[model samples]
Target: DTAVSQTPKYLVTQMGNDKSIKCEQNLGHDTMYWYKQDSKKFLKIMFSYNNKELIINETVPNRFSPKSPDKAHLNLHINSLELGDSAVYFCASSQASGGHYGYTFGSGTRLTVV
Candidate 1:
């Protein structure tokens, strides 16, 4: 019954550790996306997947990789996490309505690197 859920709601790790955050949605949406909110509260589109195909936005770090097993799930794997990588990662989904409709976001996973 959760519309969207992300595990490891809060993560605190060393500067060079690797981490993975899992996300799943049961809303039966056609598209899912990952957005990173910076310290300044600027939300940026990181990666998007639909139908097992990827549609990335701007240039995200190579260390950040998104995997979508199916339309219902998209997981993010980060390698060599840095202090700058510490941010609130949100997983969202929207019905395929040409991006006009709003998206439903998960509670969010907060990652803190020390």
Candidate 2:
């Protein structure tokens, strides 16, 4: 099985709707990250947490929230979705000690806001 997995690989919803993407990692890592990739393939870090604690929250909109129920799972929820929210969201995990290597990534979730 994949070390990291994300459900709802593809999501299509209308504007002003709310949706969520779930992610889980069985790598026994301590850190997890949420990333977004735009049409031009520009990847941006949206949120990150270590040991289920919020670590880094880039300048993402308030509508985007990341929740970690435990060290092994992290989920992204978006409210009042807009067309600009269309993008590929990726989930990743790594060791918190080094915080720089051995990252296992999930097959990404493509979200489209129509």
Candidate 3:
């Protein structure tokens, strides 16, 4: 079983359009997160959810939203996609209630805006 999976490994779209990417994990984890890796390779946390509750990271943009239906799934929705949104989105998960444990990330979903 795949521990974590993200769809549309690559996505190209025009600015002003809305798009979404799906993610799922089979690791029986209770927490999931969305991270953005910009061209410079800086990894930034967008949102984190544990048991469907929001744990927003202030560094992220308002246009980005993360939704988790359960512990095993987290999806990202981007509104009014902009050139600045051109980056790789990674879905990650870790054991619930732990901080020392590292997170497992998906290969990545590269979003290109034109």
lDDT of each: 0.92, 0.94, 0.90
Alpha-carbon deviation at 113 in model 1, angstroms:
0.6
Model 2 clash pairs are none
lDDT of 1 by residue, 1-97 (tens): 7899999899999998999999999999989999999999899999998866897656998999999999999999999999999899999998886
Shift in Å, residue 81, candidate 2: 0.2
Which regions of candidate 3 are displaced past 4 Å?
Answer: none
Model 1 TM-score is 0.95
Weakest 10 consecutive residues of candidate 3 by summed lDDT: 53-62
TM-score of each: 0.95, 0.97, 0.94
Model 3 scores a TM of 0.94
lDDT of 2 by residue, 15-83 (tens): 999999999999899999999999999989999999999999999999999999999999999999999
| lDDT for residue 7 in candidate 3, whole number 0-100 | 97
RMSD over all Cα atoms, model 1 = 1.1
- Model 1 scores what on Cα lDDT? 0.92
Candidate 3 C-alpha lDDT tens digits along 1-114: 678999989999999999999999999888888988999999988889887888766577779878788878899999999998999999998887756789999889999999
Ranking by lDDT: 2, 1, 3
